[model samples]
Target chain A: MANKLFDIIKSDLAELETALHESVVSPVATITEIGNHLIKAGGKRLRPAMFFLAARCSENFDLKRVMPLAVALELIHMASLVHDDVLDSAATRRGEATANAKWGNQLAILAGDYLFAKAFVLVTENGYGERVNNQLSRLLADLSAGELIQNKEIYKASCDTEEYYERIAMKTANFLAISCQLGAHVMGLPEKDVQALYDYGYSVGMAFQLTDDLLDLTGDSKTIGKPAGNDILQGIITLPAIRALETSPDKDELLSIVTNRDMTKEDLNRALEIVRATDGIDFTKNKVEEYLDRARNVLPESIPEDVRAAYMMAADFIAGREF
Target chain B: MANKLFDIIKSDLAELETALHESVVSPVATITEIGNHLIKAGGKRLRPAMFFLAARCSENFDLKRVMPLAVALELIHMASLVHDDVLDSAATRRGEATANAKWGNQLAILAGDYLFAKAFVLVTENGYGERVNNQLSRLLADLSAGELIQNKEIYKASCDTEEYYERIAMKTANFLAISCQLGAHVMGLPEKDVQALYDYGYSVGMAFQLTDDLLDLTGDSKTIGKPAGNDILQGIITLPAIRALETSPDKDELLSIVTNRDMTKEDLNRALEIVRATDGIDFTKNKVEEYLDRARNVLPESIPEDVRAAYMMAADFIAGREF
Candidate 1:
């Protein structure tokens, strides 16, 4: 099913890749070098794909008008990742040295800003007017606010499930939701359909983030492109960790290790054991299923059947992917 | 005359202040705290003032419509300064602890991003359309590119005058020029007048930056709100130092001091003395005068005479200010 969806949007995805590459070209050689590095780095391009599918579902789908916005959405995602790597002090992403690790934080920060500017330039050049710009700007704000909230919550073992949901909603879900909303909007979809796409995107995005957190514990470093247990090591309390904190018998040891400024290898190994022993992973998987169900349920009957099927398949992939 | 210009824009400036303060308010407490810290630190509000004056210079002056863009412009300037303080590792700015110095690099980076996002929100909320957003986004790209170029050129003793101009043009002048351009644009000015305002702004912005570079060597730490000779200490080759390297008998000494990663107080003092002793300050002063003259010459005859007078006075102040 996922393969079918990929095949459907394959050409649009290729066009998006070209647009993304062309957007990052700059007069500054170093900027071009760093930007191209990020572009060439592999991403699933899920956001752009979702955007394209949503547009195709609309009554007035025009590839020419919607392509730039689709590309802009992907660029925003990339820009956030670049800055996130800086904030996380991440050494590698997708098995490649991060821009921050290679060129230093100064250059990385500027590169992120450069990508963001280019995104806006694309929006403006393509005549996506005030409403779209406003939506994109708000997404930027939500992304930053989510990061700020996550930064403040680091290592706080007492952080609840609700807070975890809020953080991921702002950090991950909002952008995805807006991407779908924008795709529908640009194609002149009715308000009801736009809202439905937004809901669909939101539910799927939540499942995507929950699965990502689970992968941080269960996935392999090579397959996932970074070390397993990275979020726990960094003291970030994701959904699984929070669930484990609530249910694990060795809650004290788990909290201590997770909250420690520097955890030894033994501590990390033991914390992983504690989390795995609990229902944390199972609980997270169940939550993903719930959100995926909601995503499937939100498909408006008005959407084309094939588009709905593709979106459902995309949600399934997001919920079930191992890496 | 500068005071007269300020007097004219006094109420609007106050309103802009309120708007800026309100714009940074967030649901997140830390973001609000850090944002207010920047707002209360006291800047001359030069960008907002210039924007207001430019709008008033237009035939269809309407404060209701233009005030938001003016505030947005100032926010962009403030956002850049916040990030710049991080890159410069600046401890103090505007006679207060910088956001980076107070909150650490992590929060400071987030704060800078928060401001940029809020600036966009303002643009969107105020219905500044695609053209304005495009220009603003391009200006952002220019700012980042300029910073990258400056970072690359640090401590290169052989850096030439043309390179220095190019860097400042991107880093500083473009923002100011765009502020004027946006103001004229919002007021429904013709292309010719809008171009005139942009030219006027570009020339004045160049003079503004040159004066600021001069102040780094010559101004008092207490008055300028940062340490004197900071550019040299940081290995930033500003205009005066570039000229000094070219014309001073102590060229090698100046070059060595400027290029040193760590310069002691005595080294800084000696570099300052060398720059002062040479024709560097005089050369920079002449350059400021040249730009200021160009600014004055570009004012459209269609602009209200009083508005032109005020803009000319503002240029004079920029070129002649001590700090």
Candidate 2:
């Protein structure tokens, strides 16, 4: 499904790739190297894809005009990830050494700052309007605040579903939602249509994160690009774990494993068993389906059938994605 | 001289304080705490003062119109300093615990990012025009790039005076130049006057940094905030040290101490003595005077005499400042 959707906007993503490569080049060799390292690490480019898909809903979908904004979106995502790796002390991301691991924490911090500044340089160079600028600014604040909040919550067994939702909303959902809304907005869509795109992106984003957390527990290292149960090992209690805490028969043992920073492999295996024995996995899958349904249902009726179908396919692809 | 200049901008500076305090307050307790920690550390507020003084050159100056820009200038400066502390592993700044020291590098990184985003948010809220935005975007890139370059050169005894100048230009001078230009541009000043203000800011910025480097070698910890020879101890080869590398009779000894990251107290003391014996100290002082002269020379004749006097006083203050 993702491959089919990619085929629809394949050329635009290619242009974005070239633009992203060119954007990170700098006089400072270290910055350029780190930027290239991140670029080659390979992401799904979900935000840019969503941006292009939403723009396709409008008649005036000019790639030339919208390319900078799309690039800025991805760069912002990359910058946050670089900083996230530093905060997490993550050695590898997506099966590759992280910038911090490759070039120490100090250089990684500077490289992240460089990427962030470069994002703004691209946007301001294109003279993006106040709405885009304002949204980007707010988005940055939310990204960092969300990370800070998540950092503060690490190892807490009491981490609840509502808190989990708010964290994912700030960290992922709003970013995707804004990506779609901005794409629709710059293509001259009406307010109603823009809001619809936002809603669609939000639903998909929620589903996307739920799937990600699920894979952290269920997927193998080769497929997921990290060790199984990486988040739990890092003391990041996600939705599945939260649900398990509420419903697991062995709740006290699970809670102890979740709270202990030094849990053994046996502890991890047992915690995984406890979560799977309860309704936790099923509850999370249901939630993901519910969000994807909301996404598919929110596609504006005025959009051409082909574009609408593509959006639906995108949502479906997110639902079934393992990595 | 600094006290006299402060008296001139007293009320405006007071307003900027309130705005900066309010700007950093956030719903996240950690962010708010770190932000306030930075605010309480008490920087010189040199960037904002330069901005206000540049704006005062134009009759159209309105404090309300330019207040957000002023707040943003200071925020950018503060944000860079926060990140700088993390990069340097600095324990204290301005006689207070650095964010990294008190909260750890991870939170400090996030706090720095939060401050940076807040600065952009303030600017976008005011909708500053493309030129201002462009300069700011470039300013951020330069700031980070400067740090990266400087970080790369750490403990390299062969580092040259030219490289040192390039680093300071990117890290400090360009930021100051843009601050003055943005202030003048926002006040509807002519291109020539804007350029003049930029030059004035640039010259003073060079002198300011040169003086800072000197203080690190010559002034005691009580007056300079950090201990004397702190820069050398951190393996940061500044201008005076670069000069000593050129002209010191004990050049090999100095180079060995610099290259050896584990230099002892005797090595540091010997290195300091070598630097003081050469033209290193005097050469850097002469360079400071040269830049200050250029700064004073560039004050536009179109400005009122009293405003001109204030700008002169600001430059003079940079020349004589111990901290």
Candidate 3:
């Protein structure tokens, strides 16, 4: 299954790189310098993979027709991350210093705007519109709101799990679902299949994030390329941290650290131990694997064996990803 | 001519108001406060007006059907302005303290994102898709490039008029043109009519900015709701300032004042006087009025008299507004 998807990704891979590089900003004199800088920085290109894989499963699927949708989803994800870093005041992303920290918030904001414009332009030129275009665009709205809500709740040690689920669902999972759903719909897939992809992708995304959050607490900096406990440092209350704070005997003790700048490396290490010892990482990672299993179950048993492997690969990729 | 447009504006007022208010974002927990502040703080709501008016003139015009297109245009316009202020470090808009200044850059950036989300939601929810929705989304990409170009030219006191025209055409005029184009397309207008409205709105929006730039130098604070010559302080290189800087005997002196913050109130006043005396305002404003005339000429004489009147009124509103 992964092999077929990889072949598809290989052919148009250059197109994605080209569109992202050139369309990042108009040849405007001033903002382009900073815009180019961020666009050039590497990203994992994960969303596109999911898009290609999911679209190929549909009888209506056509890889040539769906490249722009794939690009659009990735671009929206990239644009949001750009803005999110500025909002988070993050110093680095994908292992490089961020646009905002390096160039100031003004350029970062404009650069993100530039990417968004490019994404839409790509979609329009490729003729993704009406129902599919509208649905994907609406998902962007939801994703953006989820980001804002997540930002608002960052470090609220007592933040509700339901809100946490809702926030992450919007910001991370829903777009993946939309990406999969869009690919299927664009190929003119049946409504049921499109919806199934959407459900599977959404749950998988949630699971991916839950595992990612757990890894932020347990994974090495080299493996993740992000500092361990960085989310907690930023006061972002992820699922694992939420669990540990709820069940731990030192719940009130952990509560003070919610806004406390005094949370040292020692504290982070200790919290990691507590979160791990309390089964927090296991709880979230288990939930993540559960979604991946469900996503696997959603695949049509009648799919060509090659296509089936690609879908299975997606499940494997999310499950095995260290970060 | 203005009276006719006003009559149309008056008679079909309720729906536009509902669309405008409906364009207001909902009470999402995080975005509720900041989002509403900008939405409720009324703009002239001109973007929506252009959209609705163009839809009304379409052969397949459905008055009730194109509301989302109208609302979406306004959201895109508003989002751009909110983000632009942060880029420009503008202190006030519509006589109120700006979103960035009031809420800090974080909230303003998030608020702009919220508006953008809402805009696309409106677009997709309106039952539009395919080329129309794709085309509308691409406008954002064009607009962002235009802004990047604008940022590049800022404080280049000797910037040429062509560059100025291109920037405003993209950043300001494109939204208006798209507003009309989408309006017509969504309402099932004849292809010829939709293109005509697009060109008409494009020309009118260019004219609108030309007059607006003139007003930046000459309009009173109470009338324009901004300090006369505020653009000079912000280092925005408007067309009038571009031309005047080229011709003034005190040209270097004027450029210095316009580009540098060291200029006193006296220097600011002198720069304004020089721009005025150089026929800069008249030059720009006359060019603006010419576009308005051209827009009027573009409306096919075969149009119903009422529709023609409304289109001309909309152009006049752009050309003649005090602000």
Per-residue lDDT tens digits of candidate 2, residues A269-323?
8898888888888899999999999999998999977778778888878888887
lDDT of 3 at B288: 86
Native contact fraction per model: 0.69, 0.70, 0.62
**Candidate 2 residue-wise lDDT, B118-145, digit = tens:** 8888898897876677778789989999
Query: Which candidate achieves the best DockQ against the true structure?
Result: 2
- Kindly report, for each predicted structure in the order presented, the TM-score of its chain A compared with the true chain A: 0.96, 0.97, 0.90
Please, what are the lDDT tens digits per residue for candidate 1 over residues B1-323?
Answer: 22656676778888887887888888899898988888899788888887888888766788889877887788788888888888888888877899889988877887777778788888888876778888888898898889988877677664688988999999878778888888888888889988999998899999999999999888986668777998887778988888889888999998898888888999999999999998889999999999999999998889887778788889878976887
Write down the RMSD of all candidates, one decimal each. 2.1, 1.6, 3.2
Per candidate, chain B TM-score?
A: 0.95, 0.97, 0.91
lDDT of 3 by residue, B1-323 (tens): 22435565554455665666656645564466665666666687777777767777756766667766776777788888999888877888876778888877766787787788677777767667656666666787778777666655556674687878888898778878887787777777778888888988899888888878888888988898878987787678898888888877777878888888566788889988888888777788789889999899887555567778878877777777776
Q: How accurate is candidate 1 locally (lDDT)?
A: 0.85
- How close to the true structure is residue B166 of candidate 2, measured as C-alpha lDDT? 86
> What does DockQ come to for candidate 2?
0.78
How close to the true structure is residue A9 of candidate 1, measured as C-alpha lDDT? 78
